[model samples]
Target: MTTKITWLGHSAFQVETAGKTILLDPFFTGNPAATVSADSVAADAILITHGHGDHIGDTVDIAKRTGALVVANFEIVTWLQGQGLENVHAMHIGGSHAFDFGTVKLTIAHHGSALPDNSYGGNPAGIILKTADGNIYFAGDTALFSDMQLIGDEDLEVAVLPIGDNFTMGPDDSVKATNFLSPRIVIPQHYNTWPLINQDTAAWETNINLQTSATPVVLQVGEHFDLS
Candidate 1:
């Protein structure tokens, strides 16, 4: 089967594989780079990497309307439930779970977790998806970490990383991360949203292309990359 990975701008993504539509950090409401409205998309599950307002964007509204299962850290899941979202699965870092779509493992990420409502969100995480097509690593808003080499053991087909500097790793660090993960394909994210986090993605892509064995796939918002 073919797996489709769509960049929704910022760090938001839509992954379709094995008859399931999984959304990661589905922020859209206030996102200037958003391509789709929150309620307009269909999903089987929603994956949250952290509780930040941008990352958790329209989870409450989308989940309630579509009845999609929301997956996140314990605190974020609890907070979502309190917001009247009934279907939720709470998973923490270093834990892996299997759903109908595929398998998911949450990896460590160097970032903070504070919900929009001031709730105590748990640790931020990078999510790994193992599917029939291949493995995809979604490195949520994070800084460069050495443990990414450990994550490379999964034999990943693609890796999604942040290149925005202020809140996450910059171009140089993201290139370092690409070398550490060493996936077949690497995609850049979490940049160009605003001036503070702005980045020259083409330059970053060029740097990665020269420094790493991985192919740097710089996607415009809503563009799709398929692994068949």
Candidate 2:
């Protein structure tokens, strides 16, 4: 079975695999290239890395409309429940949970997770998705850390990382991350939405190719790639 990966701009993505559909950080509403509106996106499950507005964008509306199970840290889950989203599974870092589609392991990430209301948002985490085809690592808004070598030991097929700087790793550090993670393919995200995080993705891809063995995949907003 092949897993289809689609980039919906910013940090949002759709992963289709094993007869299930999963959405990650659905921030499509205000995005210029967002093809589907918040109320129209559907998924069997949704994984949130943190509680930032850009990452949790439209999650409340999307969860209400699709009835997808929301997965994230304990605090975020509790917050979502407080917002009337009942179907949520709260898992802490280093915990793994089995779902209908696959197993999701919460990995470490260096970022803040406070909600806009100034409430404790929960521990930020990256998601490691183990599917039938291969392992996918979504490094949700992080800085370059040495532990990525341990993640690389898992033999990941694809790694979705942020190269947007300011909020996450910049292009140079992302290149280092690619070398440490050593995934077969690397997809850059969390850039170009606003001026604060704007980046030249094409140049970043070239720099990564030169600095690491991993192949860099640059996806336009709403573009999909099939990974078998």
Task: Report RMSD (Å) for each prediction in the order shown.
Answer: 0.7, 1.1
Misplaced by over 4 Å in model 1 are none
lDDT of 1 by residue, 91-144 (tens): 999999999999989999999999997878989999999999999999999999
The prediction achieving the highest TM-score against the true structure is 1
Q: Candidate 2's error at 59, in angstroms? A: 1.1
Location of the lowest summed lDDT over 10 successive residues in candidate 2: 27-36
* Per-prediction TM-score: 0.98, 0.97
C-alpha positional error of residue 157 in candidate 1 after TM-score superposition, expressed in Å: 0.7
Model 2: how far residue 134 lies from native, Å = 0.4
For candidate 2, write residues 1-228 as lDDT tens digits.
799999998899999999998999998877765778888787889999999888888888889988999999999999999999999999999999889999999999999998857799988899999998899999999999999999998789999999999989999999999999999999999888888899998899889878899989999888987899
